[model samples]
Target: MSIIPSIFGGRRSSIFDPFSLDIWDPFREFPIPSSSDLSNETSALVNARVDWKETPEAHIFKADLPGIKKEELKVEVEDGNVLQIFGERNVEKEDKNDKWHRVERSSGRFTRRFRLPENAKMEEVKAAMENGVLTITVPKTEAKKTDVKSVEIKSLESYIQVLIDVLTAETRQNRVTPLVSVYEESCYRKISSEFL
Candidate 1:
């Protein structure tokens, strides 16, 4: 009697061999997408990214931090110009242990720091955390001006004397003298203002 091949024992061939594919064609024809690109396509409920901007008067920082708690977050100044932010995220199964067949949520620590401009005022800095996001702002210090007062010249004599002194000093110091010399020539002069 001839025995027929058992259906279960029938030989089967794999559609594609992994080893053969690797050896035959090592280079991937299609480019792989990066984490940033993948995250951008997803909704905020799934992933979040950071965004920031700066203005002449202040610097603003904003970050998406959904599903996080105030107790898990911390903000501190590392130095005069460093702003640091750190936080931890923990996701546990709400139901009893066995009911959770899969855990896909991410859990870890997140941190970021910013190096502020020299004019930033640490004392005036402020931060707020709300709706799973954080925003921080630091104001810039006002610009300063020179302290010297203006000198009034009523007569051409006084003006010429002043101009000579200015030109002599400028030329001796290898600084620009054309401005002082022009003023001196336009106004008639007699004696050196310093000696007189």
Candidate 2:
């Protein structure tokens, strides 16, 4: 009446069981692996990771591509704001009699993109690869200085009206009557002098 197979139902004890390992064993030691220990094929399958830094003159981008050749990598900018990086990693050749015990290394194509800031100078961007690391530089455009200007008032009436509106708002919020009175007296004096 049982639907489960005999191999699946039996209680078994073996060295391969994951739960059998002793966590507190004093003689057991585990070593951490470094980036250099990984095969090129394994590292290429991962998406390109990058670091971005901004300076007064330019923006810099550094990407990790340990096993990729400069000829296989590409860098591009689109619509002035989008930055793209892509590349491919070829798989190693295998012999007819060789057997793969494990395949932790991955081989394929990968790409990464970023949206640049408004100040980036897309036209002057440059890219270079050294020691399997890609570095990109995008210069920033100089900021324009703002100019202050004085507008002339053609008529006294319009000038008085603008002053009154500003004073009204100021009086309502801060009860600043002295400023309004001073401005009103000065305007009246100027108008009277013009008429006389």
lDDT of 1 at 119: 82
Estimate, for each residue in 83-160, the C-alpha lDDT of model 1 and write its tens digit.
888877776648555554333345667677788878888778888899977888888887776799887756756666
lDDT value for model 1: 0.67
Backbone clash total for model 2 is 1
Off by over 4 Å in 1: 1-48, 93-96, 146-196
lDDT of each: 0.67, 0.76
State residue 188's C-alpha deviation in candidate 2, in Å: 2.7
In Å, residue 58's CA in model 1 sits off its true spot by 1.9
Q: Tell me each candidate's TM-score.
A: 0.50, 0.54
User: Model 1, poorest ten-residue lDDT window?
Assistant: 19-28
